[model samples]
Target: MENTESRNTAFEDIGQRISKAAKASRRSVSDIELVAISKTRTADEIRPLLDRGHRVFGENRVQEAAGKWPELRQDYADVELHLVGQLQSNKAADAVELFDAIHSIDRLSLVKALAKAMDKLDRRIPCFVQVNIGEESQKGGCAIEDTASLISQAQAAGIKVAGLMCVPPSNVSPAPYFALLAKLAKGNGLKGLSMGMSGDFESAIMLGATHIRVGTALFGERSSAG
Candidate 1:
């Protein structure tokens, strides 16, 4: 676990980096949202960031978030949680109940499930249709060619399609992938681009990533025990 002082310093450093990237791109710093990826981190591990006034976070699993956030939100009521991993259709209701935003809407089944869940709960949850930007067989995102249709389908189902999200192929320059996502969002008449990570977020910001999901840079590498 990271000590409070180191965590605070890291948090501030990330904020400064984001500001610099946003300015370099001629974009507003306020427009880029930094979603601290908190999956696999315990509540105690996350509390220090909250103490530092950081609120937005991303979790990979609905069940993991359910285990912690309800209790944590009791104290930090304004905390915004985003689901940033592959979501199964069966968990749509639980996700609709918890996450402030969903960034992995990739398939029609998931979209329909989310739409049904939102209607049942009477809560409109914003979603980012994940695009398999690198065309990786192992990753979870809608195929690049299917992105437009997915966004349209999500909107027609009453799901608030916020934008698009993607994880570029690892060990390569991510700038092109980020640019492609931005272009795709613009083509679909969307604004949010949820791309970037701890390692490449600066490039992502320069290429117009509206939201960056950072984990190891904020929380440090996860222990083997996790």
Candidate 2:
């Protein structure tokens, strides 16, 4: 049972949050789109979110997306799926097929493999180049220094490199990192700046973020793995 009343309440609450944040940031509510990272989330949770008309969905792992997307798509074919986690070369084919847009085209191997997979399928999916702007060793992305070269290489290989993505350091302001990614995108002639998250998305928007991969704030804490 959807329980339309509960769905409406959740939608209104999240919309109000979006409204207040957008006003405070001096941006229009439509300027930012929230991707509900539903990785590791069961359909019982997702169906309600979708029922509320929240169509943007994000997943972290390829296999999890592979498993979940089929059922989700069967039910909610209109929801847009985004891959917001590290992608592996071995799983590139499935990723290429599953995601409408991949926000984590980070490594050279993954990019190359994605190109190959799309080529084999005779398709070209939109992709964002992940930049480890904060340079965290645990983070998976091409460094800011390597982003331009990677984007050029991907474009040459027939992959459409649309923009830059990054994760800012925790406990520090994310504005600089978001701004840097925006500058990098403009300097390199890229269009999308995929930065920020549940915590720092406002900072990201202030710095010209076109895409914010929000998770916890939208769907609560996700499971350890998706």
Candidate 3:
């Protein structure tokens, strides 16, 4: 694990990189939100970033976030949580209560479930329609062709469709996928693009991403146990 000073340094470095990317692309750094990916990270590990005043974070599972954030939020009351991984329809109610935003609405069932959960909770949680940019069978996102309908359906159900999110195919250039996501968001009249990670976040910012999900770059490598 990294010491507190080292962790702060890493956070500063990522902020600087984000500024550089935003400036080079002629975009306002303030318009971009950095969601420190906090899945698989323990409370002790996450506290430093919280202490450093990073309020927005992303998690991959509802159960894992439920286990940790409730306690963390008691202390850092302003923290915002975003769900950034595959979500089962059964967990929709739990997710509606926990996440400030959800970035994995890839199907009609999940959309309907989220709508029902949000209605019951009386919280209209914002959502990102995840698009399968790479078209890989193993990944979790709606088909590109389904993007418009899904966004429209979510909006109709009173879900705040914020934008689109994607995990581009690894070991290749991500610009094309980022560009495609931007195009999809534009076509759908959406703006948020949650599409970056540890290795290629700079490219993501350059290509009009409003939300970049960063993990290892801020928290360092995760152990297998996490």
Provide the overall lDDT of each model, using Cα atoms, as 2-decimal numbers.
Answer: 0.95, 0.82, 0.94
What is the Cα-based TM-score of model 1? 0.98
List residue ranges in candidate 2 displaced over 4 A.
Answer: 1-11, 24-26, 222-226
Tens digits of per-residue lDDT for model 3, 184-223: 9999899899988999999999999999999999988888
Give the alpha carbon lDDT tens digit for every residue of 57-166 in model 1: 99999999999999999999999999999999999999999999999999999999999999999999899999999999999999999999999899999999999999
Predicted structure 2: lDDT: 0.82
Give Cα distance to truth, residue 111, candidate 1, Å: 0.7
Residue-pair clashes per prediction, in order, are 0, 0, 0
Report the Cα lDDT for residue 156, model 1.
Answer: 96
Which 10 consecutive residues of model 2 have the lowest summed lDDT?
1-10
The candidate, 1 or 2, that scores higher on lDDT is 1
Once fitted onto the true fold, the runs of candidate 1 whose alpha carbons sit more than 4 angstroms away are: none
Give every collision pair in model 1. none
Least accurate 10 contiguous residues by lDDT in model 3: 1-10
lDDT of 2 by residue, 62-169 (tens): 888787778878878898899989888898998888888998888778878998999898878889999998999998889888988999988888988878888888
